[model samples]
Target chain A: MPRTRIPVVAGWFTEDTAEEGFRLLGTRCSGCRSVHFPREDDHCRNPGCPGGELEEVALSKRGTVWSCTDGRYRPPPPYVSDPAVPWVPYTLVAVELAAERMVVLGQAAPGVGVGDLPVGSVVEVVPGVLEEDPAADTVHTTWHWRPVAVEALS
Target chain B: MSGDVAVLGAGMHPWGKWGRSFVSYGRAAARAALDDAGIGWPEVGSVVGAQTVRGGYPGYVAGATFARALGWQGARVTSVYAACASGAQAINTARAQILAGMADVVLVVGADAAPKGFFAPAGGDRPDDPDWLRFRVLGATNPAYFGLYARRRMALYGDSPDDFALVKVKNAAAGALNAYARYRTPVTAEEVAASAVVADPLRLLDICATSDGAAALVLCGMDFARRRGVADPVRIRAVSTVTPTFPRTVLDLPDIGTDSAVAVEPSPESFRASIARSAYEEAGIGPEDLSLAEVYDLSTALELEWYEDIGLCGPGEGAKLVREGVTALGGRIPVNASGGLASFGEAVPAQAIAQVCELTWQLRGQAGDRQVPGARVGITANQGLFGHGSAVVAVR
Candidate 1:
């Protein structure tokens, strides 16, 4: 049985790309101009601020690497990691979005080894797989951030 | 509006993996509280439940679920979900009802049946969820954040792992005296060092466990308490349920990233600090007036953070206070006098209520061995996932 592997949330990004590139979508208040990811359908969360209609805003596609670290151990269940295939250390990065004014986290792109990127480096949004559970027969999908491959400017 | 509600009674079902339903735990706690208050269940005018997350669903609603288990008697019911701070919010909700004269007597309950091991986000292909993103992408479990905080403390305040281990040593010894705690055996620095490292810089004993537990409180208006002949009860003078102010810079739980300080300068007082500050302001008391405190010691190092955040000491003075035996029982303003999460593990919805339950017992001088001498005023502080912060001030 072929099951459609999909992002559990709706309207959170531009669209899933074959190259796995998509801009995460959020909402911005027209009045105070506060941004919300997963899009706050309600009023602005900027406390006691004047009411403003929320508009869907595609966030900046790239951001500076804020911080990065990786887990050397398996997290508890509900985060679908394969118990069989030995744990592979993966890098995690926090990206700073200028427009959204918040830091967003995602997995580093494949082959982006530890120590390759440092804080303040620029990275861009790219798609990634969450997990492939052989027992339940599903391939969970997610997003990642890859280094922009900028030329070294002396 | 300094006139506050009275905490007539408080109770808890001991925390551990008993493999029973959360409803049973809640009902037992509720009954114990009613017995302590000398009140009948039918006279309770309202009930508020602190919700839990179970099997990827919202945790069984403590109000309706436990009410159902006890046979609902037409009490107004409310359920609150705020991750760890749910219980305190439930008590806050009940206090509001009592103060409003909407209900003279209200029952507040929170309970949880937690899974064994590191807590994780719900199951799904949820890329947009920050919690799931942290787990799937980084495999950053709760311990990783604890490790980050511990390491940051070490770097900033020169807190050693041995200093962090002392928290467990103190708390476990206190837990050994507490019948309601999960791990009652006193721990040693050697044992903490020998324990498996879940995250770099934080050992297994450094982190609190996830266990099944329940807590409940009986609250009533001042007039109602007097009428019930419960004079001079432990009064809940203030409940500070404040949100972080603008430019919250610290990375909190269930969030992938932090608010960038590029636009505006971060506040001088962090959100965690503000939670206790608001409580002090509402109670018209200062940290100096407190005889004991119940802080969220989710990790041994995190306890040290609370020492600073709660203003028991300065930012870098937490480890020093612990090393000086200033936070243990018989110490000045003894912290985590209920043994805290270090002893009890975490029961999510039940914890904040449990924190107050400890304060209530201590204020009444009924906490057997873990009691602070002449305990008069106590403060309980906790933070929940997704920007929820809570603290309660109780005075005899």
Candidate 2:
């Protein structure tokens, strides 16, 4: 049986391949014009703002790398990784979105390591796998950061 | 200042991976503090406990637990939980009670029996929990954040892994002189280089471990101290428990992203710098007055960050201070004279209290081997999870 792909955490991103797709989702306050990632559905977090309705908005697709690192040891659960198999290190990136003026953390794309993404380098959000549960026949989908090629800038 | 509270006594149970209940450690430390103060537990007017979440329900109401364990005399009890800053918050509560005339003397105790290996969040599949989501979604462990900060320092300040190793070497030398430290043996930079990398740009030796430890203090008003024939005691001048301002630009632990700066411009000073600044303002002192310091060294790189944050040096000069031996013992300003978390792994709630214990001893001229000569004033800086900021200033 083929595994069904689903977001590890729902409503965090879109898997769409179109221009508008594969972007992380956040909430922007109508009154304050401030944005929040991980979707603050309640209200504006800005203390100075009186109050505002939070509207779901897609975050910037591309951002510059603020910092990046790799996890050499296996993180304990609920970060699911089979202990029977040797742990493979994964790169994590903190990208700075200029429009939102916020830094978001995510896993680097498969085959992308810390050496590839230097600080201030451009990276784009891409859909990727968080984990796979064979028993449940499920593929946990999440977001990955991939470094943009320099040639693409021209 | 009228807000001053005297530190009558300070004590601790040595930090290590000791397989013992946190209650036992807390009880022992409490007794030691009572003895140091030359006062019995029954005479205590109030008791404050720093909560340990891993210890079940009893840990939540730690004040009553310790009070009962010490044969409760019906002392007013309080418990505080603020992640790493629990101890400092507990101290703050006790000081408030003393200043309010509710209690002439207050006992502050913190203890923890941590699990082995990496510290994971509580179990459950709660989508709303940011800590859980970060781990499940990105597998970003605590070390990952440390690695990010270390890399940032390297990129921004031209710091190298060797500079990070120097922190461990200097701290380990101090730890050797501390009787309560777990890893007392001095570590060399060569050994640090050989250790496996737990996170990129940080070696195994760079990160702190989890341990079972306890610390306790007895605090009283100045009048009460003079009445007890102690004219001059180590006085806690300030306890800063400030929260972060809006649009927190720096990414902290257990958070996936920083607050948006679109609406409010980000503060020129980082949240950490503010934590120490608030304490200094409250104490009416500055970094120049510090004879010694004990900042949270969860990682070697973090210790350097704290140097800049606590005003021990200017921005991006942490590595230079270490290289010049300015932060080492016998230098301009000694830091982590008790060996820091590098020597004594994190006991969460107990660690911050232990920092104060070191300050108390240093200010009193009681720190034998690791003592800062002519130590008159000392400060401790630590930050808890969420937005809890903690810093304490003590003077002789």
Please report the candidate that would top TM-score against the real structure: 2
Error of 1 at B130 (Å): 3.9
lDDT string for model 2 (A1-154, tens) is: 5789888888888864653377999999999999998889987889998787999998999999999999999998889999999999999999999999999999999999999999999999988988888889999999899999999976
Model 1's CAPRI class?
A: acceptable
Task: Flag clash pairs in model 1.
Answer: A20-A127, B52-B59
lDDT of 1 by residue, B1-396 (tens): 346899988888999999998888999999989888988999999999999767433365557887888797999999988888899999999998888889989999988888888888877677667777666555778877776667657756778899999999999988899999998999999999999877667788999999999999999988888998888999999999998986676667777656544335568998999999999999999999999999999999999999999899988999999999999888987998888899999999999999999999998989998888898888999998888989999999
Candidate No. with top DockQ: 2
Which segments of candidate 2 are over 4 A away from where they belong? A16-20
Query: Could you estimate the TM-score for every candidate?
Result: 0.84, 0.99
TM-score of chain B of each: 0.98, 0.99
Overall lDDT per candidate, in order of appearance: 0.82, 0.92
Give the per-residue Cα lDDT of candidate 1 at A96. Answer: 76
Task: Please give the range of 10 consecutive residues that has the lowest summed lDDT in model 2 chain B.
Answer: B52-61
Candidate 2 local Cα displacement, residue B152, angstroms? 0.5
TM-score of the A chain in model 1: 0.84
lDDT of 1 at B72: 70
Chain A only TM-scores, each candidate in turn: 0.84, 0.95
Docking quality band of candidate 2, CAPRI definitions: high
